[model samples]
Target chain A: MRGGDAGFDEFVRERYDQLLRYAIMLTGRRWDAEEIVQEALLRCLRRWRRVPADNAVAYVRKAIYHEFLRVARRKPQVPLDELAEQLDLEDFAPAVVARDHVLVVLQQLPPRQRAAVLARVVLDLSEAQTAVELDCSVGTVKSLTSRGMARIRQLWAAEQAAAPGRRGT
Target chain B: MIAEEQEYATRLREELADVAVRASAGQVDTVLRQVHRRRRDRRNQRIQVFTAMAVVALAVAGAFAVTTAGEHAEPARQVDATTPMAQWPARGELAADKDLVARAEQAWHSYRQPPRGPLKPLFAGVSPNMSANMVVVALIAPESGQVAFVTTPIRVNRPSDPRDRLLVRAVAPVTPEQRGVGFMASRPLPEDEPPIDQNAVGMALTSPAAENGKVYTSTIDSQSEPSWPTTVVGALWPQYEMGAGAWNSELRVQFRGAASTEDYTLVTGVSDDVDLGPVALRRAGAALRAEGPGVRQGDLIITPNGVVGVVAAPDGTVDTRLSELAAHGTVGVAISRVPGRVREVGDHAEFTATGPGDFGEEQRLVLQAWDEPRLALTFAKLAGYEPHWLVARTAGPDAAENVLRLGKPGAAKP
Candidate 1:
């Protein structure tokens, strides 16, 4: 890692966007999600030699999750409006709004549960993989994902019900 | 339910797809440059914290595993709740006793995890003015490396009213796990010439964590108003229970400068190196076999059901997995005797150097970095281990140096 800036650069270029997406799931705010990924990347660079090359992506992702857990403890139950303040709301693109609406609900899930859902579903990690990333057992992944998804389903359902016409999409 | 899970997964991927880093390449490069600069600055600002391992040449030094081997290990629960607190030294006691100050610095700030109940202070008495002063007691589960504390007032450690015997009795042994605390004079690393030595102070003890306290960061925040009482002493004994985290058990210490109003908290965490994968449960004879949970290099495992069974293993590996009943279940607790508290037990005391290696290199670095390598050697001496070769392999590589035994006293040997 002493002279490995090149590898670090390439990792950022290829994985930054992907890492951001993962962060969004863990941290509802785009700003915090990006910040977590960025900080993790910096640390990844510091301990670069110790981390196996094959596990770089997973390394950063796990760091993101751990960062979320630590940050979650520091700032408890963030309000949706405060999260909104992190964004430039003028755009209001439907994709952005849709993500926003869902995040509002997702924010209600515990940090661990949110990380579980993102890993199992969005990131497409298996129960074992999710467990490893989140530092829990496979059984825990199942339970967290199950409970988290159940809540998301309920919220998604309610959202659709309110805007039946918009639900067509 | 599986289909529903898949549906939920699919919807999330679609909805959250747009989320990505928008920072331009130039912006990113700038950030990296800034990060690199900060790292460089920190290293430049760094002081020599044990640049050389005070090399002392001698014989009769090799890596020794003086492990108590659990046979004689006392279950923390079974251990007597004796108060091990050091008496608060008088102002005269604060006079330049370099050796005693070094001993206090070397004392293990953290003790082994005690079972939860209520904590008894090694010995907490009133300050010179009779403002009650007590040490905080914390429990750490060796298996989980999880720590919990019996929160107490700075002035009144367990707050026992003279009339409240029942209250005191019920809370007498609150912690269920082993317990310990670190008492360094400086709460933080001083940025001056010798960042290694905690700012040589008159008498500054750490203030416990509180909402009304001024200690901001968990680390890198030290404020010791060097007054008298420098040769202070206190110990953490179990009194009450503070539960462990399911995993990622953290060690938290609240420190306040005895002379300053603000207090700070320092935290570190420990967890089993678990592996989780498509392990097929198999039994070969009386013993059950599974490719133990190293699922992958860094993936974590959690039990589906809340219960995790602790299994007894000759080596402390399979304790945090599923039990036969909890099986097909992730492993659970298999309690065994873990190394307990390090206190004045005759001429020797024990300190758990969990820096990342079985040897004490990392711990040495931490102590030395915090200006306490001499403290490590001092503990080694207290434990009656010669200064030639010691090992703290369970800690980290930085830990390798911690356990090295350098040499004999004045008697010279090659």
Candidate 2:
């Protein structure tokens, strides 16, 4: 499935939502996640003429994840002033206030471990498939997901104990 | 799947569904527009570069130094350097095949040339590893200085030449020392010990390191010469064990741009090629592609190289998630409510309990001024103790809600 611009654009139209969601999970902030996806799509379009259709989806998915990783790797985050500057750029962000108890805990996990749990347990990707995506061994995926889940449970319990004691993952 | 995993998924689905980020149709439209505009701007910059070079060509200029990656490097075909980057047709994604094989396949397709015309590839099998400073074949668009024939980022690894596969078909496992553990009390060499001399053989992997020093299972053809260093180094973090000590420790697997090795040791198998060849590369690619660029933020990918590494491509993605986490990364997980600012350290910090009668056995302390949420209330005490054993009294009122840690702090995330 080589991707021509038409096909590539079509791909973007279909998966933009899912990609955005994945990016948001990868990056805690929405605008940054959106930016990452857009950049990935652009990279895809740049090579649309050459991208194999079979590989385009994987390519973009890789690009999105990589983009998030790259952004996450950037040194000491922008100061609070810069954060405000970015927040001010959003024209209308009504959902910004809707914070989740689980996401707060999720944010605390090692980025890769967090990604493992999401890709494996939540998304139900096979361990082998998840390993391919994570560029690790089956054992690593097992270890990461296991540790990640345990941490999630601990964090969830902690969050619940602090607040309303809601049952957690 | 385990019951815990099932339970986690159920809880996760419910929570994430309730809070997954979303965007409006307008926002999506804007993204599409902006990204395409950026692509166009990039092409336009290439065109501008060509124009600038042409203008410089007209002006007085000194002879330039020729930069080359290899001693016998060949020059690319020179063009007028006046063409726009967009004019040159972009050949699509490169497949996993080598130059000779691609040529062979191209020749095979000669008679089957698409009904359209003679199948002329602008070029074939551009190495995924090539970049600006070290391009194998330079195709600067006419005069624009824009790279017309950009190299692919994915290396080409074709199937083995059957004869070569027969060379070491009966390969056995490596040793425990190579596995980094069985021999010593610990697998990792003590931090005090000097590092191994990686350049023993002169191979890039054996050398200090390469950009993104990722090791994949590789084999170097053994040399009869006495000067030849052993291809088998200690095992670094590898995709799988070929046996023990087949490769060097993970710290020894050096790559350029790679800060830390992911422990994927590239085994130096006995092979026809002196260094990593098609077979090893194909295996590496397969393994890497299978392992998704080892989860960036959390997406799994397969590549010896990180998708977004410490060094990013010019204008590539720049993630700030981890850095932000590093800033305000922790919290007081085990503590009860804010027991004021208990300034203390070690496995446990004893705070004066004004509320021993007010609170239960468990107690908490929150600190201020840090982004990390990990400032856990670290303390352990017997159940029926009376008040008076308090070491430090947390003085401030709202300061209890701030950031602080009490206990032997566990290693924080990088």
Candidate 3:
């Protein structure tokens, strides 16, 4: 019934869907992503009294990142075949196939490199912000992103060379 | 120019714009409902804690106020009483002494045969005119442990001054073994101090035999860490139930410091065995075999440099010297444990080694397994940077058998 509780309800209603989408992108599984978002929101609510109004979204995002890291550390290895199957290439256009192929190649990189590339490109965060989120220096993030992209390009070229008929793009 | 690269990047981003983010409507509802439930639960917990703290504060305040009023009234009453000095002093001292004796007795009684089910005070004592009172009881279950309690005083007035009368009572279990270890007062360390760097200072549970019940409070020390200590009192039993086993399990207590980073206090037993699921074992074995000297199931390899030791089996898996092996390279030797079985192409294998070798040093070694191509390479030179000496395993197919040098800029050619 308090004014603060009412405000929190409003905040949750507005950002729940967006946060869920972000979590889904990060985790690559709907069930795990939803669980992560729900846990993040609950944690945010517990400390709502101290959270600054301006940075509420940032706090929620940080919580999501922390939860993701916790789960990733516990189960670091993912089955390659399962991950490959999860990438639905049929949804892409001819030009998009090249990009999808690039993403598949990106998946082959180490976990840290893949995380850096996604945080930079897919999430569109600044280099400094991505570095802070990863608890690393900006130089490390830049290096990882560069190396990750180079590997993707090499794999794409190799795939194109091997499959001549599918190289229309 | 770099502009062309940037343009290509922009096009790549736009092409992948349709990556769908999908979750079922039911899933969303479930998550939202869980969030709401947790919020409510946490709010209720906070309210309960605040309420309990408030009650203790009020009781103490009330007791202090009543004691002050009694002191003021005593002076006025003294003038009216024309009684003899001998009678007055003896009565006053006797009453005080009797009260102290009664409290001590109550504390002793509460220690023995603590009540089961809900917690309750076993003994209650109130001062004359009911101005101050005390109750003593055990807090937790007798089997789990014992906790003592003392009540706050009821203040007559002047609550704003932050002074209150207090009635205190103490209770402990009858048997020394049943009684919980008493509280250890600790001073907060500096902000920069590690949370759990020091040895445990508190009491530890002691078990006599494998199946016997555990006794509490075996050891106590000052200047110890905050978390409780658990002593491994017995060896692993052949057959024991989960959670009731006397198995040699490692105990770890984690503490978070003021900086919000967690530090762990770990204790290890001499022998410990943990089951790695089939999938994990298979993956680990494959990763190990791909990177180092290939190992098949049941084959043993003894390294000449005292670094690598592995036993390989026929099932395309290797049992390393240790369950977790630190990464290092040295001129050690490996022998095939499997007598007749041969390592074929495309087979997943694992190699493990143990030793006091520098992780950064580059060294050459030969790998000979039955029926497999002979392997010769310098692992440190091939793996790029120095491998972590504690545990490092990589997963990939076997590269070519020629000299495999590590730390090359590009991928090493098989």
Top candidate on DockQ is 2
lDDT of 3 by residue, B1-414 (tens): 156445445644665465444333433443555566456445544654665577578678987774643441222224112332111221111123334434433443454443444332222222111111111111333443333433323222112111122222222232323211121101111211221112111111111211221211101111223321111121111111111111111112222223321111111111112111111122463344412332233322222111122434344343344321222122232111111111112322223233221112122222222221211211111122222222222211231111111121122323
State the DockQ of every prediction: 0.13, 0.16, 0.11
Give me the runs in candidate 2 sitting further than 4 Å from their true place: A75-99, B20-22, B58-414
lDDT of 1 by residue, B319-373 (tens): 2221121122111111111112232234332343211111212122111111211
Question: What TM-score should be assigned to candidate 1?
Answer: 0.37
What ranges in model 3 sit over 4 Å off? A1-6, A49-55, A86-106, A164-169, B1-8, B22-29, B42-414
Q: Comparing 2 and 3 by lDDT, which wins?
A: 2
Clashes of 3: 40
Whole-structure CA lDDT of model 3: 0.37
Worst 10 residues of 2 chain B by lDDT: B179-188
In the range B1-414, model 2's lDDT, one tens digit per residue, is: 579667866787677775544444544554665565456446544644664576467443433544443232223333222323222222211221235323433333332221122222222222111111111111222222222112111111222221110111001122211211100011111221221111111111122112233232211112122111111122111211111122221223333355543342232322211111111111232122111122122211111111111111122122211112112223221222222322234533344432211222323222211332211112223222233223322221112121111111222322
**What's the CA error at residue B275 for candidate 3, in Å?**
51
After TM-score superposition, the amount by which residue A105's alpha carbon in candidate 1 deviates from its true location, in angstroms, is 2.7
Residue B15 error for model 3, in Å? 4.4
Write one digit per residue (lDDT tens) for candidate 1, span A17-56.
Answer: 6776678767777657756876777777778767777778
Best candidate, lDDT = 1
